[model samples]
Target: MIKHIVMWKLLDAAQAPRFKAELDSCKGLVPGMREFEVGIRTEGMEANHDVVLNSTFDDAAALEAYVVHPHHKKVSAYLGTLRESRAVLDYST
Candidate 1:
């Protein structure tokens, strides 16, 4: 399996809910998507990013397909406007 984790620092932290919603829209968007979870930083938590996307795909090919999927691209484009910085980690498990 491939784990794809992404954390984003938003330009405005208040937009975390919106960010999470946008990411949630991509759940089950492609074949082989095993799990998709979107999370907003908890209040008063020790964290650097405003939102996170923790997902798993059946394999590297599924991960690749998700990356290029049009819906994912659109969501990414919208999120780009709201993000200050992004951190990503992808690994096979």
Candidate 2:
């Protein structure tokens, strides 16, 4: 299995609700995505990201399929306009 994680720094923390709605839209874009979850950070943790996503895929190829999927690309392009910075990670167990 592959665990894909993403941390997003939005233009404003207040914008997190909007971003979460958009993030949920990504679930239908990739057939291999086993699960998807998004979180908004409101605790004022100094080092916390504004938004985070957890996604699981069956394997590397399935995850790769999500990366190149057209719908995913479309959502990513929209995300660009709302983000200040982003980080990502993927690993298997």
Which candidate number has the best lDDT? Answer: 1
Q: Candidate 2: how large is its RMSD?
A: 1.5
Residue 89, model 1, lDDT: 100
Error in Å for residue 43 of model 1: 0.8
Q: Check candidate 1 and list the clashing pairs.
A: none
Candidate 2, pairs of clashing residues? none
lDDT (Cα, tens digit) per residue for candidate 2, span 1-93 = 999999999888788898888888888566678989998886756656798999999899989998898878887889879999999999996
**Model 2, stretches more than 4 Å misplaced?**
44-47
Per-residue CA lDDT of model 1 for 54-89, tens digit only, reads 999999999999999999999999999999999999
Deviation of model 1 at 85, angstroms: 0.3
Query: Number of backbone collisions per candidate, in order?
Result: 0, 0
**lDDT of every model, 2 decimals:** 0.95, 0.87
